[model samples]
Target: MKSNDKLAIHELLNKAAYGYDSRNVDMLVDCFAEGAVMSMSITDGDLIGPFEGQNEIMKLMTGAMEGQMDTRLHNISNIFFEKEADEAATVLSSLTLTAVENGSIRLLTTGIYRDEVVKVGGSWKISKRHLDLELPF
Candidate 1:
């Protein structure tokens, strides 16, 4: 991959984390493609979803946001490309989730995010994502 493409992918991943951290609906919405899908597995348990389509994915995200009482920080790290091409890539990264409540902070979970991203209209957008969490957050 070109250096610029790598950087853009990194930025795209970080943007998604920042969107969730700040609860910015528009930012979150912008990170996904129209037909994006998301799924998760917690503690090696059964698959929680393959929430197909951007709307379903957003519904899952918004519902989680509503249920939270603390400020969340989703730290993305160890990003690497497993495969890449001009229009699409498979990426992997680590997630460290923390929550702050009542002036105290604690680790909620750590996870591995496997994402498939594609260039759409000159920007990288997540087309599919599957998160494997070490614990329920």
Candidate 2:
């Protein structure tokens, strides 16, 4: 893959994390393609969802955002590319989630994000994402 594509993909992943942390709905929506899918697993428990399509995924995201009263920090790191092409890539990254409420900050969880992204109109957008959490947040 080209270096620019790799950079763009990295930015895309960071943008998603930032969007969620900042509660920027529009930014989060832009990160996903129309048919995007998302799922999660916590501590080897049952799968949460294979939330199909952008609308369903947004419902899940917005719900989570509304439920949280604290400030969230979703730190994305250790990004690696498992596969790449001109228009698509599979990426794996680590998440260290923290929340701040009042004067206290707490570590919520750590997780892994596996994402399939495609270039849509010259921008990378997540087509599929699966998250595995070490603990429930």
Model 1 TM-score, all chains together = 0.98
- Candidate 2 Cα outliers beyond 4 Å, as residue runs: none
Pairs in clash, predicted candidate 1: none
Q: In model 1, what lDDT does residue 50 have?
A: 92
Per-model TM values vs. the true structure? 0.98, 0.98
Off by over 4 Å in 1: none
Error of 2 at 33 (Å): 0.6
lDDT of 1 by residue, 87-134 (tens): 999999999999999999999999999999999999999999999999
What lDDT tens digits, residue by residue, belong to model 2 across residues 1-137? 89999999999999999998888989999999999999999999999999999999999999999999999999999999999889999999999999999999999999999999999999999999999999999
Cα RMSD for candidate 1?
0.6
Query: Where's the lowest-lDDT run of ten residues in candidate 1?
Result: 20-29
